[model samples]
Structure formats: C-alpha cells, structure tokens
Target: MRRLTKIAAVTAVMALAVTGCAKKDTQTSSASGSSDKGGLCASGGSGPKIGLAYDIGGRGDKSFNDLAAAGTKKASEDLDATCKESEAAPDEPDSAKEERLRTLADAGYDPIIAVGFVYTPMVTTVAKEYPKLKFAIVDGAAEGDNVTNLAFSPEQGSFLVGVAAGLKTKTNKVGFVGGVKGPIIDPFAAGYQAGVKAVNPKATVEMKWLSDQADQKAFANPPGGKTAATALYDNGADIVFHASGLSGNGVFEAAAAEDKLAIGVDSDQYLTAPKDQQSHILTSALKRVDVAVYDFAKAFKDGTTKAGFDVYDLKRDGVGYATSGGQIDDIKDQIDSYKEKIVSGEIKVPNTL
Candidate 1:
C-alpha cells in the first residue's frame, strides 16, 4: 500500500547496463527494496549477486514491474544480496532484451531474473549458454538445466476483485479492460467475468482488450486504457477492473473523472495511485510477484534451486485482493467466504471462459 519510488514508465528510452561496463542514462539500480515500514529491510550481510531485467513498463509503472522490484528489495533484505537492473523500451525488439540478459550474465550475476514472459526466448536461449549460472523468468517458460519459471495463478486473484466489483456495482454493469488477449491475459478476463456472474447472475460484464494478441504496447498505453475505460463508463458501467499493467493508470484517471470506481491489478494500487484516484480504486487483485521472486532467490542461495515451474495460487497466499481506502470494508467478509469456498473446492473458479 505504500507509494512506490521507482520511476514511472513515461517514455520509451532507457539506459543499457552491465556490471563492469559503463551505464548509459544511469538506468541501472543497485537492487534495493521499497522502504521497510519498521526498517525491517536493513542489510544483514553480503549475499548473492542479482541481475534483473524488467518488462516494457519497467519499474515505476506502479504495477507489475514495481512488484518485481519489490521482490528484489525483499531479496536484498533477507539475503543481503546485491542487484543490478536494466529496463525495456516501449517498442524495442526481443534482441534488446537478449543483449541485456547477456550483459547481466557476462557481468557474473548469478540467479539472474527476467521480469516478464517476453524473456522466455532470451532466458531459454541464454540459460543454455551459461550452464554454470542460474536464471528465473517471471510468467514464462524455458527449457534448460539452470532456468526456473516463476508462475502464478493470477486468475484466482482476479476472481476475488471481480467479486468485489460484482458486489459493489450499482448499475449491475461492470467492465474488464485487458492490456492484451493471450494465454496469460485471457484468464484474467475469464475469472473476472466469472466472479461477477457468480455473485450477480444478471450482471453484464463489458469486456475489451487494448490489443488483440501478445502485444507489449497494449500494457503500456495509458491513453488507450483511458479511452477504453471511459467508453465503458459512458456505456453505463459503474465499476471497472483492469488487467492492463501500467495502462491501468489511465483507467484510474478515467474512473475518477467519470465519478466511477475501478479495481487495480498486481499491487495494491489504492495505496500507490495518485491522491485523487485513490478514492475511486475499489481494490486491487494481489499477485505476489515479490514473494515469488524472493523465494526464487532464496532457493538459489540455499542451494535448493531447481529448474521448473513454481506456481503461486490462492491457497498459497500468492494471489488475493487488496483492502485499502476501506472501499469494500463491509463486503470483505463476503469476499472471504468466496475465497474459503474456492480453497475448499466448493466453488470452482474457472481460469477460462
């Protein structure tokens, strides 16, 4: 819920980084965590060296990339590790990411983390070349002896937020704005719609994808997010939920302007959103990328690291809904009841429509 410190994803230009090489534009950061409320993140000792590559939005997107940054901070605290990072440009090709990964690897950073699924190819290819080094990809898959996949059941969290939206909607009309439509994003839309329909069968869910395929720009375009959410609000949706990365910032803007409510994704956006937009955020679907990232680092440090998929589901507390701004206080118990049912197998939350 704390306001984030990472810079916002406002431009397409970023600096390149390597451990031994000179940094351009100073985009690289010595991995650090968001402020620890009680100063709990004080460095304990020297630990592992980390290399992080962010998604297009990078850190400061106040959503996905920031959460990944939080994970590095956590790792820095718990493991007292040193970290270096590089970001992706707005429309840069995959080659750019591969080069970044190569530089991090070349710099001798162990257990390097790639912050998005787009890095699957790079990680799969790069990990093969660096057999002695460790690699992990968030929301991606790759075959290698040193690669691990940090995946999450984000649909479960989306379902929880959808429940909030469904219970809170005044007009019985809700909308979902997806940054892109694909295997990773489809579940968000499906779980949201399912949650809405589950609570209010008569409710109508207006769904739209900013992009039709696996386009990275869809998640970066705040203007598109605003336009999509604005149109939905104009069509009578009183509440909207977005799974559109940084673009969701625009959704919050539209919601505040239209005097409507919105649900955020990845992080507890209510705490990080601008003061004006804070009141309008119903809640955010919590995807604990931070925990997963830290776990991967810990595994690597402890020498138990393995190459495979690590899935964080609702039962694992890896996914849930936020409760900031007290917008859904009265209905929290109702949402918890649904969560219990889901955990107990009483309610089957579909990952797809």
Candidate 2:
C-alpha cells in the first residue's frame, strides 16, 4: 500500500503536467537518476520538485532573498529534491509574476516558493487552480487552502539591533535607512526607533526612506541608498541600520568611505560587504528565512508538513541578532542580556510600523 501511494503521487504530478493545466516555457532534464543522495528526493523514491521565485532584487543582496535561497539550497542538499529558481524583474507586473508561478507549477514543481511579500497575489491566484500542488510564501502570508505562509517577526530581532546601535554610538545619534515606506520596511524602522529609545532616551534617530510610497524603484536603487547614507552621516549620525535591500550596499559604501558604522539586516552582511569596510559593521538583525524553508522542505518530505500560516519568532530561534568577526564584542554582553529579557518575557518587542 505504501509503495502504491508513492507511485500514485508521482503519477498525479506527471498527469497534471501532461494535461497542459500548468504551462511552462522552460524545462531541463538530468541524466542522473533520482536518488536520495542529495536529500532533495525522498527515500525509496524520486525527490520532490521545488521551485523558487526571487523578489525584484533577486539574489546577492545579502538580505531577505539570499537567506531564502540558502534555505532552498539546504533543502535541496538534505532532502533529495530538484530545485528550480526564477528571477523576476524589479518592476515586473502582477501578470508577469502570475505567469512565472504558473510556469514553475506546469514544470512539475510540487511546492513553488515565492520569496517575498510582493508575490502574495501571484501565489494566491496560482495556488487556487492546482489544489494538490503546494505553495509557500515568505515574508508575507497568503490565505489559501494549499498555500503555507511563512512570516518572520523581524521586530523581535530589530529591537535587539536597535539596542546594540543605541549602546555603541559614541555620538548618541543613529540613522535608519529603509528601502521604501511600506508595510514591510516600516517594522525595521519602528523597532529600531523603539530599541534606541529604550537604551538612550535622548538618542536622536534620523529616519529616511530611499523612496516615497509610490516609488517602485526603491529596492534596487543603490545610488539612492548611498546618497541617503551620506546625508545621514553628514547630519551627525555615527551609526546607521539599513533595511534597504540592494540599496543597502550603497549605504555600506558610504559608511566605509566616511569612517562610520552601519548595521545590516536579514543576513550577516559583514561578510557580504567589502573586507576593508567590515570594521564599520556593528551587527546584523537576522531573519532566519533559510531555517524556515529547510524545515518546511523536511516536513513536506516526511509527509508531516501542514498548510497554514507559520510564524517564526525569537522564541523559536527564527529571528535574532548576529555577532560575527568580533564586530559586536564591545556590547555583546548587553545584547545577550537583552536577549534573555526578551526570551524571559521581561521584554516585549513591538511588531508595528
């Protein structure tokens, strides 16, 4: 019966592809027979087929999308799965996103993962047509029976970063640069502001968004980020935390040239930035999207994964701060203490804009 069930699942997937229900424009075949060697495939059968659609900035931003990719890579390595990825244009419209999701689905990917909140509508529309097909959306939630929404409580980590920035700033002034003013970018700014106020009530936090709410070019505009960082530094901000995606690279460059410090988000960007400018990195507010993706893949492989909204927080080690290269040693103890308070319920980090 177990063998028959396994065969049935594979047949269903192939049948869906043959019927042209899901239309794909690209397809690649590998001679390597499916095995559990890489763990992308399940034991005693071919691996699961996974698809990932990256956000506007794609990979290499050293932030949200990269972390999601890391998780997908891990799943591919450990679960014996076949993984496919697509990069969307930054200004791609909803129709393009919908077509991409359908293409991946038609290509026989069981669980097509969308890496950012921007893919919410696309995922929702695609998920409805293929009831048996699984879908995962990161950084945002989709309300559908077949979709699993993975969300991170970034404020929990941002609060800790704010604490670090507050304690380490010699000039008692810091700045926050966001990619744009939106539901996603606001949490980082709000949490950092709250954290700064918690430590130094008088510490002035200079807040700037690279673009207004209507500016669609916000996430990928590196020059704007650099300009914002320069303006902030000139305005007397000794430390800055940026949640600006690829634009944050410009912030790091500006900080390095001006001999100031900057905090990274989503990943440990100290390594992503130039080696010479690493000294300017204070710490990073980490969002463990990779872990979530890996866990979801494992659960799907084991037939234990459920479809719903899965929220990860500091309690589950899903979000926190990163200390690497001795950049945060000066205030490590303080950061740890704050972590304890948060874990022990003494500190409640607010999740709001």
Candidate 3:
C-alpha cells in the first residue's frame, strides 16, 4: 500500500540532462486561469498554486498515482487551489525529478507534492534551494522546515485484507506480490503474512517481488506482475494481494484469467478495475493518499501544515480496507473488529518483516 522506501539508488541511474516533463509539454502549466475544462485544477480553485510530481507510470496507473490525482481534484474543489503536474519517467534518475520540482518552483508553484519516496532526496535537496516554497511528499522521509512528510500505515491495512484472504481462501493458500524489494515494500508483506497467520497459523503465503534493487521499473511492469501472480495461482493460491503499483494491473489480469480472487492496493481498485475483472477483486488495501494530500492542501492553505510527519494510520482512518464491491460485506464485522484492535493499540501490526 505504500513506499517508505529506503534510499533509492539514484546514483545508479546515469543522470540525463533531459529536463522536460515525461509529458508532451513538461513546462506547460495547466492553470485554472485558462478555460481548459480538462485541466487538473479546474475546480475553480482560488488558493495556492500546487506543483504535483507523480511517480513512474503517471496518473492512469489506477493505483498510487491515481490516488494522488484524486487528492488534487478534491483540493481544487475544497481549497480553491490550482496545480501543475509532472511525471517521473520509468527508471529515470533523481536529476529529472529535481528538475521537475525546480521547473514548478520557477513557474511559481508552491507547496509542491512529490508522490513517492523516490523523490524524497530530491525534495530534501530542492526545498533547501527554494527556501520559501512549501513541499509535501507522500511516503517520503524528506525533511525541511517547509516540507511536510505524509506517511500512511499500509501495514495496518494490509493486515485487515490478510484477514479477508485467510477467511475466504478455499485452498488455504494466498499470495503477496510487492512492486519491489526494500524497506518501503517490506511492511506490506510483513503485515499480510502476520494477518494470514493470525487467522490461519498454518496457511502459506506465496511472496514475490516484481523487481529487486537491481531493477528500478519494479512499479511499472504489468507483465511482470501478471507472470508472478499467475505462478502463485498455478501454485495453489486462491487469492492474491498485490502492493505493486502499476504492475498490480497484471495481478488483476491474472486473477481474472485464473478465476481467482485478488486484493488491490493504494486505492479502491475495485472501482478502477475493468468491468470483467471487477468481480475478481475481493478488496483493496487503501493507503488514502488522496485524503493525506487533501489534508496537506487544507493545512497549507490555513498556514497549519506540519513540518514533520503527517501520519495516516488506522487510528486516523488514513489506511484501511475498502468494501466497495460488497464482496467483503459478509466479513465486514470481522474485518472491522481487527481494524479497531489496531486502532486501539490492542494489535501491533508490524511495519517490517
């Protein structure tokens, strides 16, 4: 459900001097001042001008990036704010993200929101240079007097979905597919395994990562997600949960092809999935990035944005499991009970394996 990523190997990706958006017109700002109806900030926002930097795979991933975009939409309506956006290129180095931030700042965007931990260092370094422009990073540990770090308790939510799989699996075998192998993604696996074991101590969890440190496109490869999930299903897992970003698409595909159930991450994927595949999605572990982004936008507008962590935990309703498809309706009480225990400190879900 999140990326509390350890330091990304930015130095590993050779720096590219290319400074434009992964978008067609990287420098173009879609302001509400313009009459473009499809513009991101079209809600008649009259507040701060925001610069949003999306992680790789951009807005249509139906996972992480899409969730952040939703927050932007809500901000435009509620805070009367406007925003310009830039997207990270697959496997691009930190230099590109830095340029994206600088471009936004140069064009007068304030309180920039960088969507993932891959941009953490760049935000930390760039915020120092801008001094006055505020920044909020989702899942990043970046720090500065003007930067707000918005982190979510994905592990807590993962545990609840794990309960669903444990309760629903006919084969007593489940699967977990993470986008990458790192601290950021480990919590998901940890929480899921814990939850599964909590309900069925002997159940097996087939764990796989689409990419390791050697590969940076971990979050972008849908084919890899499909392959990994297919193997898990072939190996006897009746339900699969994927915390891989865009790659989770393939996981859904695999679920549909195999006629099995799957759990989605970061957003209510059941709402975003293809019609034929919707029924295959049992639930999604919600990271609520939109909620965090809206909270940040509101705080920034009111001059109350916190400098340190803005945690979205179970207690804060920041992270939880979604029940949109009515698939989990029968088990809602069981799931909520676990959710309450975590919120009440009776259940200590692990954030690491």
Can you give the TM-score per candidate against the true fold? 0.87, 0.86, 0.89
- Any idea how many clashes model 1 has? 1
What are the lDDT figures for the candidates, one per model? 0.78, 0.74, 0.79
Model 3 global lDDT (CA atoms, 0 to 1): 0.79
Clashes of each: 1, 10, 4
Q: What is the C-alpha RMSD of each candidate to the true structure, in Å?
A: 8.3, 10.3, 6.9
Best candidate according to lDDT: 3
Tens-digit lDDT track of model 3 for 1-353: 12234322110000011121221212225532221224566433468788888887777778777777778766776667777878776667768789888888888888899988878789989999998889998888887999888887788989999999999989999999988877678778888888988888879998998877523458888899999999999999999999888889999999999999999988888877889999999998888888888888888889988787777788888788889889989999999999889988999988777
Ranking by TM-score: 3, 1, 2
lDDT of 2 by residue, 1-353 (tens): 34222212211000001111111122323322111122222222255677778786776667777777677656655665657667776565789888888888887887888887777777878999888888888865565888887777787788899999898888999999988765677777877888888988989999888877423457777798889999999999999999888888888888999999999888888867779878888888888888888788787788776776687777888878878768678888888888889889998776555
Q: List the residue pairs that clash in candidate 3.
A: 21-26, 45-80, 46-80, 47-80
If both were scored by TM-score, which would come out higher, candidate 1 or candidate 3? 3
Per-residue accuracy of model 1 over 239-343 as CA lDDT, tens digit each: 999988888999999999999999998888887778999999999988888888889989989999988777887898888899989989999999999999988
In the predicted model 2, the residue pairs found to clash are 39-78, 39-79, 39-80, 40-79, 40-80, 40-81, 41-47, 41-79, 41-80, 41-81
